[model samples]
Every structure is written in structure tokens, then in C-alpha cells.
Target: MSSSLPLSGRVGIITGGARGIGYAIAKRLLQDGASVCLWDVDETALSEAKASLSSLGNVATAQVNVTDAASVEAAVQTTLAALGKIDLLVNNAGIAGNNAKLWELTPEEWRRVLDINLNGPFLCCRGVVPQMLKNGFGRIVNIASVAGKEGNPNASHYSASKAGVIGLTKSLGKELATSNILVNCITPAVIETDILKQMTQQHVDYMLSKIPMNRFGQKEEAAAMVAWLCSEDCSFTTGAVFDLSGGRATY
Candidate 1:
């Protein structure tokens, strides 16, 4: 590991890391000289990701259910044991959920979205922060969405869940402000990913029309931003929401 590498000697854990933006983030972190543990609920995907990423650097995989505290704790232990110490946490696991009117959504539908998008990050932070505290350094980047800021019609559950993530990032950032554990989030309008399959075409076109750039963001683009956020250079910003909305976010 060259000292010139921004993340040399750092270790990171990326939730939902088997595919999409999470997978891209794992690759970027590895390229930047950080060892990473990829966490996801799909065992097959985890194995495949590790196989593909191992040549880039030291990579580990954990089958995790972020909504469950016990599962998150086990993955934390797995990461620490594999990589020694945790320096960065990217809460990238999430779902767009089913696009529908708020009144049409069932209690289970709403809870499912909230559990994975919001509670997952909370559980991950709860489990990983102690190790970071011991190391006296940490970086937490939650993957929020522009929908959280400007609510999307027929996607109330998704919007509200991401809004909760923004709130979590702010609250946690402040609590650990003095502890050298900087926390922040990214609110992307839309990035090209398989997650789009879960959404309706009408919803997708509506989101695309809002982006002044007239195109969807690529997964690698999101990964590049996250790489910087996880690096030592991102020292001054915490509790902030960085927009990757292609001019869709006004504030």
C-alpha cells in the first residue's frame, strides 16, 4: 500500500455491496487502497462479488440482514476479524419499494421500506461505531435520495424512508462531531441500476424529466463521490447532504 493512496491502511464495510452502487463503491474503495467487507443478504451474490473483487485488494464478504440487530452485529464482528479495524461505513443498501399511492400501501409495505432504508443504517452504525471510537477515526456515508428532499408522488414510503436516513445522518453526525466520526449522506436523483426494475416506467420517466442533465447518473459516478467521502480528504464536512441529482436538487 503506497502512502500516496488516500485510503491506504483503511478498512471499510459497504452494505448492499453485492451489486449496483454498493458494488461500485466497493470497487472504488479497493482501487483507492482500502480493504473492504461486502455485506448483503444474498449469499450467492456475496460470493460472486468477493471473487470478482479479491484481485483488486483484500476483500471479504458477509451475509447480512441489515434490518436485524443480531445479524448486523455478527457482520460487524466478521468485518473486524477480517480487516482488523473499521475506518469507513457506507450505508448503501436500500430499495425503491413498490410505487403506489400512500393510501394504497399496506403497513407491511411501508415498514419494509423503512426497515431496510432507514433502520438498516441505524443498526449498522450502532454496531460499527464502537470499533471506530476505539480507533479514534471514522467516516459514515448514508445513501439517501433526492426523493427524500422533494417527495415523489406514489412513492411516499420510499421518500419517507430516505428522509429518515437524512435525519439519521444529521443526528449521528452531531453526536459524534467531537469524536472524529464524521457522518454525512448523498441524495442522488437516480442512478442506473437494477433497482430500477422495481419501479414503474412512469415513475422512472418522471424522475428523469426532473434532471436538467437529461440523463441518469451512472453507478461509477456515485462510487467516485463515495470514494472521496471515505477518504482522509473529506475531513471538514459532516452532517451534510451532498447532492448527486444532476441539477434536480435546488437546496
Candidate 2:
């Protein structure tokens, strides 16, 4: 590891850190010299990810249900006890609910997706913001989606959830701008991650077709943007939306 890495001496909590884009971000942060705690609801995946990432840097795992207040509070306490202080928060835990139009979707399905995608981040922010305030420094990066910018067909719930995330990021960013706790989000186009498994083939093809790049993005690519946002170099920006859309986003 390079001594001059940007994130050296930093510690981060990554929700949904067990797999997909979350896993990639954890690995990147570790490589950048930050100790990371992988927070996930999946104990099995957490074990596997911990084993795989332990060799790279300091790593910890905790089973967390981001949608639950008590669960998030406990995870925060555990991370603080283990890592001592948290410098970064990556709200990467979200689910792609079933693919269906608004009329076709059940209330249960809608709430489930919103609970994890929107409420989860809200809980995490509530849980961790005080710690950041105490330290007088922090970076929060929410993993929003391009779908949030332009709602996708048959994925209304997922799109709405991510849009809420973006709204949360902007509002929080402004509130904390003077406190040095930066809050921002990335709107990435379709990335090739396990979340894709939940989407139908037709939906997948439609997403790909919308990307001007003519391809799905890689998890590593999203991680790279997130890494930069998590670093001190991103100081001037907060309450902002970054585009990782493969030219799919016009605004």
C-alpha cells in the first residue's frame, strides 16, 4: 500500500457491503488505505466478503438491517467500538423490487423497496451523523441511480426510491455544508451487478439500450467515482449529484 494514499487513516461503514457494487466499493476503500466495516443483512455473504477483503486491509463485519432503527444504532455502536471513529458512510444497501408498472405493483412490493432503498439510508444517516458531527468531519455518499433521474419503465418503485435518495442527499448536504460533513450522491446507469438478477430480461435489454455506451457499466467503475467522493479531494462539492451514466443522462 502506498503511504500517500488519499484515504489513509480513514474508516468507513458500507451498508450492503456483502456483494455487488457495495463489495467493490469496500475493496477500493481498503486499497486506498481505509479500514472498513462491511454492514449487511446477510451473515453468509458477510463472512465471505470479510475473508476475501481481510487480506487487503483492516476489515470488520456486522449484520445490519438498514431499514431498522435499533439495528442501525447497534451497528453504529459496534463500528465505533471496533474502529474507534467513522470518517465515511456509504449507503449502498438497496434492492431492485419486482419489475412492474405502477398499476401492476402491489403495495407490499412498493413499500419493501422503499424501506430498503430510502428508509435504510435515512436510518443510517440518523445513526451516524452525530458521530461525524463530534469529529467535525465526514463524507456521506449515497448510491442513487440513473433511473432516479429518468424513471425507468416497469421499475417505478425502484426509481422512486432512488429519487428519494437523491432528494435526501441534497437536503442533507445543504444542512451539513457548514459542518464539514459532506453529503452527496451518484446517479449511475445500469451497472452489471447481482441486482440485475432481479430484473427481467426485457428490462435489462431496455436499460442497456438506453445507455449511449451500448453496454452495462462495471461495478469497479461505480466504485471509482465513489472512492473519489469519499476522499478529501472532493471537499468543494456537497449536496450534489454526480453522473455516471455512460452518456445516458442529459442533465
Candidate 3:
């Protein structure tokens, strides 16, 4: 891939695009050549991200609740109305609840984690598929986690939710294989982001012990992979899960 690649005419909608990995994806997409629609739940962060990313290229922003069917529908409609087409969808919004034993996790905690990590993608995909079908071209890239694969201790809900995302990606990718759309998921381990601050110290220590590289994965590393999966070069793969866990995982 060219370091200075361009995605000139494509329109992309990135959920949870206001910051972190989402922001990096949005920035990379714009740098490539796509028109970007940034959707996030935080209004202030959305506005700030819009301003910071405006220097890239054609862009827009929407405060959206990815887990809410109505909110997702409205965001998709607004995107199509303004951009006129939806070529890429990055379902990157997610939440990592406090790390605790499975027995200690409450019903509400499990529901909230699943709502954003798994259900959010369901809602966003539901909102975008019809439009994609009409155009016969769409790229969906989901951000999952290494925990989903190995099942991290004290993070039962998060693990299960990301596991569901992987399952969803595989199912959707096959379901849409006959069409122009392609769906795939990426699992990252110990990314250097604000989300890390939310994890317990023990959680961090345990994760680091497993990461053979003994370092956090950069957001740009993940963004590079996501950009490719969203690009024209991603023609032969769907329903696949790629890993960005440094030396921590290989399968």
C-alpha cells in the first residue's frame, strides 16, 4: 500500500469516530480520498474531532447511539442524503466494562457491554445494508479484540461480546458474498489508547505478560489494516478475522 494513498470519491461512515482508533481510521480514510461521516455518542467530542479532522477532506459528523436502532437509522439516512452513497462502514464503537469476575458482573453491566460491543454493529449493519444492496458495493470492517478469541479472565462480558462480533462478521460476510459488499473483523491486543486507563492494573499486567512483544500496539498499526480492508485491494477475503496482537497471537 502506498503511504500517501488516496480514496477520492468513496463515502465512508465510521461509528465511534470521534476519537481513539476510530479517529485514526477517519483520518486515514480522508487522507486516502474518501468522503467521511463521523458518528459518535459524545456531542462535544464529535464536534472537536470534526474540527481537527476537517483539514483532511470532505467530512461530516453526527452524534449517534450505535446500539439504538432508531439512532443508527437516522445516521445512515443522513449520511446517504448528504454523501449520496455509502461505500464503507467501520463499526468501531465499543465499551470495556470494569474487569471483574463473571459472578461479580451484574446484569446491567453485561447488557451495556453487549449493547455497544455486539449489538451496536447489528444496528449499524441493519441501517446500512439496504443502501449497500441498492449500490451493490459496500465494505464493512469491524474492530474486535484478542480477548474475544482466548476469553480473558475477569472480562467475561467483553470477551463474549467481541466473540459475537467475530461470529457476526463471518455470518454477514457469507450472507453478502454474492454481492459487492465484503465484511471482516480485526482483533487487537493491548492497543495504546485511553481505553487502557479503564482497565485495572492487574488487568494491564496480565495482558502485558501475554503480549510477547511487551509493548502496546499503536493505533496507526490497527488503522493501516482497517484502511486496507476497506480499500479496493480487499477483493478476495470476507468473513475473515485478522489479528494485530504483535507477537502475542498467531493463528
Candidate 4:
């Protein structure tokens, strides 16, 4: 790898890295000269992702259930074993649970989304931060959503979960401010990804209508922003939310 590449010699862990936005981020990071460890619950997809991405750079995969602390910890160890050290973490594993009004949703449904979308990142950070601190450098870029800010109707669970992610990023960022471990998050309006499949057509259309650009964002666009946030170029910013909302974000 060329020393001039921004992420050269870095090792990163990307949860939900088997596909969609996560896969795009992994590919971008690899192309930027970082080795990557893909963590996902789907073993088959993990294998496929590793096979496809191995040509770009050093790539490894671990079947992980982000919601489980044991699973997250084991994957952290696995990544350390495979890649030596972790310089970046992208908390991207999440789901758009079945759309329903807040009152109509079952407690189980609400908890499931929170467990994966919020608590998962918490565990991964807890597991990975020690290594980053030991190395005295790290970056954490969480994948939040515009819904978290606006709170889309019928997706109360997802919106709340992502909101928690934003809160987590801010608190963690402040906690690591002087440690050289920058933490931040991105709030994307609507990216074209498999997660969309879990939403109703009405909901998708409603989200699309809210964007001033009138077009869905591509996964690569999200990947590009995340790549920068994971690099040394993002040195001065931490605990901030970068908007990828195509002009939909009012704040």
C-alpha cells in the first residue's frame, strides 16, 4: 500500500459489513488502504463479502450477533487476532423493524430494534476502545438516520433507536475528547439499501418526498463520507453529526 493513502496501515472493524451501506463503507475503506474485518450475523453473507473484498486489501470476517455482548466481544478478539489492531470502528449494523404506530408496536418489537441499533454499538465500543486507547488513536463513526431527528411516523422504534445512537455518539465523543479517539455520527435521510426492504412502500415514499433533492441517496455517497470521518483528516471534529440528508435536514 502507498504511504500516501490516507488510511494506509490502519485496521478497521465494520459491523453489518456483509452488504448494503456497510459493504460500501468496507470497500471504500479498503480502497483507501485500510485492512478491514467485517462483522455480521449472516455467516453466508460474511463469507461472500470477504471473498469479494479480499482482492482490494486485507479482509477478514466474523459471524457476529451485535446484540449479544459475548458475540461482540468474541468478534473483537477475532478481529484483533486477524488484523493485529483496530484503528476505526463503524457501528453500522441495524434494522428497520416492521413499521407500526408507537402504540401498536409490541414491546418485543421495540426492544429488538433498540438491542441491535443502540446497545450493539455500545457493546462494540466497550470491547474495542481498549485497543484504540492502547494505540492512542481511534475513530468511531456511527450510522444514524434523519428519522432520529424528525421521528418519522410509523417507525417509532427505528427513529428512537437511531436517536439513541446520536446521543451515544455525543456522550462517547465527549468522554474520549482528549484521548485522540474521535467519535461522531452521520444522519442520512434515505439511502438506497437493503434495509429499505423492511419498510412499507408508503413509508419509503413519504421519506423520499421529504428530501428536497427528490432522489434517494446511493450507498457509495454514504461510504465516501464515512471514509473521511474515519481518517486523520477528521481530526478537529468530534461528537458532531454530519448530515447526508440531501437538504432534508432543517437543523
lDDT of 4 by residue, 1-251 (tens): 89999999999999999999999999999999999999999999999999999999999999999989899889999999999999999999999999999999999999999999999999999999999999999999999999999999999999999999999999999999999999999999999988889989999999999999999999999999999999999999999999999999999
Over 4 Å off, model 1: none
lDDT over C-alpha atoms for residue 149 of model 4: 94
RMSD of each: 0.6, 0.7, 1.9, 0.5
Candidate 3, 88-160: lDDT as tens digits: 9999999899899999999999999999999999999999988899998989999999999999999999999
Lowest summed lDDT over 10 consecutive residues: which window, candidate 1?
A: 1-10
Ranking by lDDT: 4, 2, 1, 3
Per residue, candidate 2 scores C-alpha lDDT tens digits across 1-251 of 67799999999999999999999999999999999999999999999999999999999988999989999999999999889999999999999999989999999999999999999999999999999999999999999999998999999999999999999999999999999999999999999998889999999999999999898889999999999999999999999999998999999
Structural similarity to truth (TM-score) of each candidate:
0.99, 0.99, 0.97, 0.99
Clashes of 4: 0
> Which is better, 2 or 3, measured by TM-score?
2
Better of 1 and 3 by lDDT: 1
Give Cα-based local distance difference scores for all models.
0.95, 0.96, 0.92, 0.96
